[model samples]
Target: MTAAVESEAPAEVLPGLYDIDAELYHSDPIPGGSLSSSGARKLATECPAKFKYWSEHPQPVKKEFELGTAAHTLILGDGPELVVVDAEKWTTNAVKAEVAAIRAEGKTPLKPSDLKRVTEMVAALRADPDAAPFLEPGSGVAEQSAFWEDHGIWRRARFDWLRHDGQLVDYKTTKSANPSDLPKVIHDWGYHQQQEYYLDAGLALDLVDPEKPFQFVLQEKEPPYLVVVTTCDPVARGIGRHLNDRALNTFALCRASGEWPGYLEAPLTALPAWVERQYA
Candidate 1:
């Protein structure tokens, strides 16, 4: 069940699926505030002070992210329209002004060459037998936002793709999509926690089945644009769930007390075991 965003803001943000714009969703217009997967991850991995600060002040878009965003627009057939700038370099004042204006209108501006690369990357992704079926244009909805309550906290998640056949798919652009390197990538970026959090949203709203594992479609940014399809195993999912719970509780406490604390001060720390073993 999907609800369309009204031209005027609703008095209350009811829990359900929504077909809303990315800008509005990120703005977090949910009444009494809401916790997103990214926010939960930040609170769990870093200090709450960092999360609080960043949440209040959204970061500016980075140039590195433009390629991935363009690819998503092409592949998922959703998101902000990409405006191709016909220029070899953006050093010129005119080119920079055009790019800025395009962004001001909520459109993504890409170099002609970058747009061509993104098109090729999408082609490579479509050719993958394992990944191709999941992203078939009419097979699912793209960029759908889900909102629901969990343990007295309003939780929200935006899915990259939700298949009609009950699968949750997330697309990621990376420097390397090699399966061997993915474990560390997943650990460092908290992909496991992200998966569990997304899954939790779907499960709460009955959009996903418990038996179905969350799917990740990872693609490399460079030449060949290799794509890999994978999912979190039970152990990883367990760890993710535990961490999410901890973050949620921490967020609740901080909100109630109006205190977002930083890391422990002046604490004694030991060197990593691997470093100690090398010295020994």
Candidate 2:
């Protein structure tokens, strides 16, 4: 007899609130290749408003690295109980070493320079009266600033961790000015679609307790900059809900209309050509 495999239930997510459907239909991203704010600024002195937003907000990008670390530890594993994806063997070994060190002492698993950057950022934030609440160890809201819920999408999101009480977070890294000021950073990065998507997916999955408030972890840095923590207010959460709902609805519309390929193709088409040009 064949053994039966139990499939996991799909995670729930919140709806998007922005005009994403319209936006997607009206405007499509250049499609492929990673571009940083500096690239955008270099592309144009004025740059697109979108790129400008990114330059003003660097935390989201740093959060990507933090998520990568979490994915390495929590999701990808080996020795018969795990599957490795997206990362190479060397990267896996490095993660294993780092995880081991975390178990050995109070020292951070991330690099010393990274830790120093984070500590300095925290100090800077604490220095600012407005940023203090979010940086304080016991700041109830700060501790549980952000939470994640699983979405049964193609790739799992890294924002799965929550405080014991279910606070979601998206940690950031930057080498910027005093880390004390958080509100401004939060405002710049918090409005992006990806942030809303994370929040929405979590909300839908019911991964986060509705009773707890939601927030993001903003890390800002310049070349010589370090980490600083920032948070969003109710308005930010509301914006997340709106944007996520729109993305979801757009996805649904694409699926039903059988026009999904266009969206997928948009990136596929541009990326290969850009890569080929690099070689040529």
TM-score each candidate.
0.93, 0.38
Off by over 4 Å in 1: 1-10, 267-280
Model 2: weakest 10-residue lDDT segment is 74-83
RMSD of 1: 2.2
| Candidate 1 lDDT, 22-138, residue by residue in tens | 888889978878999999898888899999998999886787898999999999999889998999799999999999999888898998899889999999999999989889898
Question: Candidate 2's residue-wise lDDT over 1-280, tens digit each?
Answer: 1111112221332222121221221122222112221232222222234433443354322323542333222221200111223223326776776555543432224544544444455555456564344334432221111112223222122242343454554445433335454545544544343445444444654545556544444445433333343345567656655644444444334435644332122433445777989989
User: Which structure among the candidates has the greatest lDDT?
Assistant: 1
Best by TM-score: 1
